[model samples]
Target: MSVGSENLPQFALVGGKGTGKSSLLESLVGKDFLPRGATRAPLVLNLRKSDCQEQGIFLHRPGEKIHDFSRIREEIANRTVILAGLVRLSLDCQPDNFVEQTKSTIMEYISKEETIILAVTAEGLVMSQALEQAMMVDPEGARTIGVITKLDRAQDIAMAELDNKVVPLKWGHVGVVLRSEAVKCWKY
Candidate 1:
């Protein structure tokens, strides 16, 4: 793994809302609870509000300078990372260049394994191309893992489609949101 040398194993949680993704991370780490759309400004605001909480998570907000990456890197170097809620530039971003740069930054830092889990929120729409690009950015194959969230919400998808289209393609890596007590051990 070559990460932290002494801390916990790093993992990335990517999926849509109501998938219990945030709930899962909160349950696992017990700290650094960064909700989806955790931009840099709100993080700074939250950091200031905390005043002196030792344990915290650092996430990148869109419209921030790359030099701000130092704080995030320092946090990772110190092993304070729990989870990262990535802010996709495509959301409400006007200039195409900014979005492209944002994507570049995500790919760049992910390569260093700064945060354990790159938790992406898919939220109904299949952001497959975006995920593919992110994974492909890591040429060494940094153990890509993902979860297909909100299964409970997709009643229109049908059981037959679920069995064939969804299950076969997603079984190994993607976890369908099935509410059962016995179904645990979800790390993929």
Candidate 2:
């Protein structure tokens, strides 16, 4: 599926730490129309000198503190970018005073930005409570895209179950499955 122009789609890579959000980011950058040898080993957005002229990939590593979002906010305000490895701060407590603060933090980061893509951890979605918190980060419907990573682990999750999650993927969006388990249908 293709991304629509009308929508300022925010792509989120939602999964655990090892779910390969970083690897996927590399893949996307590699696929971009970068000038030869412009891509660097460690992930960094060298937009002007970037080999990929078509797409701009920026990653915001906001340390555990929500206050660290200033750096990310600065980048959004400065230019057009596609953020990867973008994660939401996951908290367990009923932050009495911090809830609004957290939402405000996210809104501030998202406000007036031309585009923002989020990479999330699936662990946040496995339960109702976590899902609610996630909803705060990504509302019920916000043109936000989700990708569940780390299927390689999570024993209870079968390949079939994993397939179900992807089938519901919004058109033009991708729900990437990490590994392909051999299916028995072909030979029989």
Number of the predicted model whose TM-score against the real structure is largest: 1
Q: What are the models' TM-scores?
A: 0.43, 0.38
Question: Which regions of candidate 2 are displaced past 4 Å?
Answer: 1-16, 31-107, 110-119, 122-124, 128-134, 155-188
Residue range with the least summed lDDT across 10 consecutive positions in model 1: 40-49
Q: Over the stretch 49-81, how does candidate 1's per-residue lDDT look in tens digits?
A: 133433233344433333233454454433322
Query: lDDT scores for all predictions?
Result: 0.40, 0.36
Highest lDDT against the true fold, candidate: 1
Candidate 1, superposed: residue stretches over 4 Å from native = 1-9, 13-24, 35-54, 57-96, 113-127, 138-142, 155-171, 176-188
